[model samples]
Target chain A: MRTIFYISDGTALTAEAFGRAMLSMFPLKVVHKTLAFIDTEAKATAAVNKINQAYADSGERPVIFHTFVSIDIKRIIMSSQGSCYDFLDYFVTPLSKELGIPAQPKTHRTHGIQEDTGVRENYDFRIDAVNYSLANDDGSNVANYDEADIILLGVSRTGKTPTSLYLALHYGIKAANYPLTEDDNMENLQLPKVLKPHRHKIFGLTLDPQRLHEIRSKRREGSTYASLPQCRFELQEVEKMYRREAIPFLDSTRFSVEEIAAKILAETNIERHRF
Target chain B: MRTIFYISDGTALTAEAFGRAMLSMFPLKVVHKTLAFIDTEAKATAAVNKINQAYADSGERPVIFHTFVSIDIKRIIMSSQGSCYDFLDYFVTPLSKELGIPAQPKTHRTHGIQEDTGVRENYDFRIDAVNYSLANDDGSNVANYDEADIILLGVSRTGKTPTSLYLALHYGIKAANYPLTEDDNMENLQLPKVLKPHRHKIFGLTLDPQRLHEIRSKRREGSTYASLPQCRFELQEVEKMYRREAIPFLDSTRFSVEEIAAKILAETNIERHRF
Candidate 1:
């Protein structure tokens, strides 16, 4: 029954995310509204009125979350008859003092098109990594094995492709994944020719057979490939390969793509190229 | 010469991003530190001392950015000698008032494993879209054109792949991209047979010839394909094809992947499935 207002001078993605994170802790059904691009005084005033109206209607104060860079607009928002939390107002003065420089507040500059030429190189790096991941996906373009930062080896439907893409997209890491086939499993789980030279850069993904069975069943219903015994066999063989090759492996059953990416980066000691 | 500290009870990504955005406004070279997993009073005390030490050493107050769910830890951080800004303290009371519920401060629950089953469906949607983008990248598997939410058409290296991946990764939109080849251009700007049926869902991307040349040359140097004339001819023909086919096009010469993705979503009226 509560209204949560997110106000921002920019994209308000961070405000939205932080607000959701904090609000989810309480067991309540809440109405969330986001007012982005609130750079003008008139817009700020409009927001204040909307918030006050909500408070009056519900007989409860609306919680206003804002990340505004303009002191003037922030003052107008702070004057609203709601529970006002301004991100910049609480920190800018102290930051100015600590840095020995005055704050130059710019509207919509946080997540907007960057005029900072310094971030271009990093942006290009990430784009290149993303392209590399696509090109080398599923071991299709193994000719460029030498350029990969890490090679993920797993059986079918073990989250190799998504993990690789997440790593590339988020960390700018050149990740390639090779699917371990049934032939490899039957042939004593030896490393493929293309992957042998990149042994040091290889990581494996493992999961419980039951979970794998559930995932594969959804993709290929009533098929032998998706059967429980087939999943169990594949997982056992992959674990054997990982142990035999001394490749670090992770069980991706309970982990999200974010967690999987963090683990891969941390385990491999790969330095993330931040933008 | 100042120190910037990002303290959080969770992953600290928001705290870090907010700190960076705010710090970039001030022209100062600041040393950045992230103290994550600050869920305990002991951790908060240690962070306070660390902030004090940095302040004492530099003779400048450190700027501490925090998103603490716990009031006790927030109090400890606010008591530090540095300039402390706690995201929760300024808003939690009002949010409680607005929601008609008490704030249950939990640490590390924001970005950790989700206990919410409702989000699980959306997560699967995103993963499926990512797989679709990878499978359909660069016209590799265009057989599923009927299933796509949107199909992007562009020449090679016109940023088709990255944009498609971004759309899929962020919004769970089943985006498939087809590269406009020379054959399609030489055939009197005709649409490819594979793309003719799904013309309504197609979007075109165009960029400067020089930028295209620069990107292609890096991939395949010293070739007619990467020559200026080739890039110019291809770009000119693609624009002609876009006009002939009546495909909505975007000039992606200077936009970042993030900007391009947003533009694509907005122009196509494609609903973004937020996480």
Candidate 2:
């Protein structure tokens, strides 16, 4: 197994998020072992020394990859002479292209502070502690279908709502979801007719009957919908539909909303550029 | 505007998260941004030169700050001696320490690609997924408490539910909230008396009366709670109570759940270390 470090200078949430996403691709393989941080300048050398040691201590030849913080530093590291210097030559070139970020060609005056603050609390986006009103504040679903990066379809409480919201907040992915209501389900082929044409983009969700029953119980207890027997039958039917239709489906019973969302993203091969 | 490349080699989410947090901190300034990534040798070099141009072209001196994925790259750049090599030195020394990580370091081989995988399809953690054996799985307040990292206290629909779930999925902060019914309101504090001691950790939610009215009106057209006048009066009373008890609050009329949450985290000085 190769050890990979997802380094970030900001809050590291971005690093963790993308890290988590990559791991999800190989769910049973990548484990984010530990998170190490450096928030200031004095610690830069120490952080460097440790990475260098990573190579020396390992008896095996491991890929020692590294990315730096600024234009000046990149140039400096690119020019530095040392045993680890060769490692930099080995990793920095190709890594930049896949990410779409351009390299710093020259070093001008840099606002160089050496410590790792991880993030700067600048409060740069809010004005008067209120967001500027959206062009359409009426919640009329003015968002166009064409503009949606991905669309989710599931029955109510299948964890779609939270999943859509997570993508929006984390990846800025504009996601839209449609619920398969009782009427729609009653009128269904294994797949929703409207989704037939968008088959590749469409994904399905299913839940263990008992789990669905428990979740629905919290929303509307004592209702027929929340009854265990009813849920059991509904789940069986949904699973059958998914199999018959050959739609990619996930059991939402065990996954956290994010996990379920990630699974769908993975299974459906939803190519989200920004999100 | 100065450019800021929130670069990441492995996970872009962490960089974006820190970017958002930094943006929130500095609402007025526009920092040129890029959450682009670098994972291979070529892409890494291109990204280095891109930052070079941003700083080189921007007439003024700009900070070339980098974080997580960039840590190692920072060293690479620092090692590359040049006109900017002196500046690179400042960042390298301190970074070395954090890279060393774990004062008492623990090393182990990776077991999976991700440390956690949402809950997993087997509902492995869903006690019910196994047998009814969990029925006797420890008669403790454990599940109830284990279900939330923070339990919000407020009246019905004061934005507790969304925020609670958001914290859970986003920060993995287990959050559950209990509403302050009329009974609790009369007691003058939103928090349940039993939970008062944990008050510092509890966040009190309140909304402008008119806004509250508009929200309630959607669900209960003619109910007293939906009346404009009643909403105004309730809001006044709630604000007064908050002041009397010195409970911090935010007006939810214009805030998205994410914004409300971000504000609360900031005001409460709760640093979600993930990002």
Candidate 1, residues B1-275: lDDT per residue as tens digits?
Answer: 67888887665666766676676577665777777668799988998999999988998788887887677878898899988766656666766665667877753355444546345566778888998887888898878988898999988889998889888987789899999887675546678888989999999999999988988999999788899888888888888989987899998887777667766764576766653
Consecutive 10-residue window with the lowest summed lDDT within model 1 chain B? B106-115
Question: RMSD, each candidate, Å?
Answer: 4.5, 13.1
Model 1, residue pairs in steric clash: none
Model 1, B251: alpha-carbon shift in Å?
A: 2.5
Q: Over the stretch A115-138, how does candidate 1's per-residue lDDT look in tens digits?
A: 463556667788899989978888
lDDT of 2 at A15: 37
State the displacement of the C-alpha of residue A258, model 2, in Å, after optimal TM-score superposition.
7.2
Candidate 2 lDDT by residue in tens digits, B1-275? 55555544433333443333333323223344442335455665666666666657764333333333344554543232111212122323333342332221111101112225334322322222111211111111324533333556565556665565455444445455656555655434443455555556566778867666766786699997688886666666667766766778877654545556655664565544232
Candidate that would win on DockQ: 1
Cand 2, B chain, TM: 0.49
The alpha-carbon deviation from the true structure for residue B45 of candidate 1, after best TM-score superposition, in angstroms, is: 9.7
DockQ of each: 0.35, 0.06
Give TM-scores for every candidate, taking all chains together and pairing residue i with residue i.
0.81, 0.42
Lowest summed lDDT window (length 10), candidate 2 chain A:
A128-137
**lDDT at B134, model 2:** 16
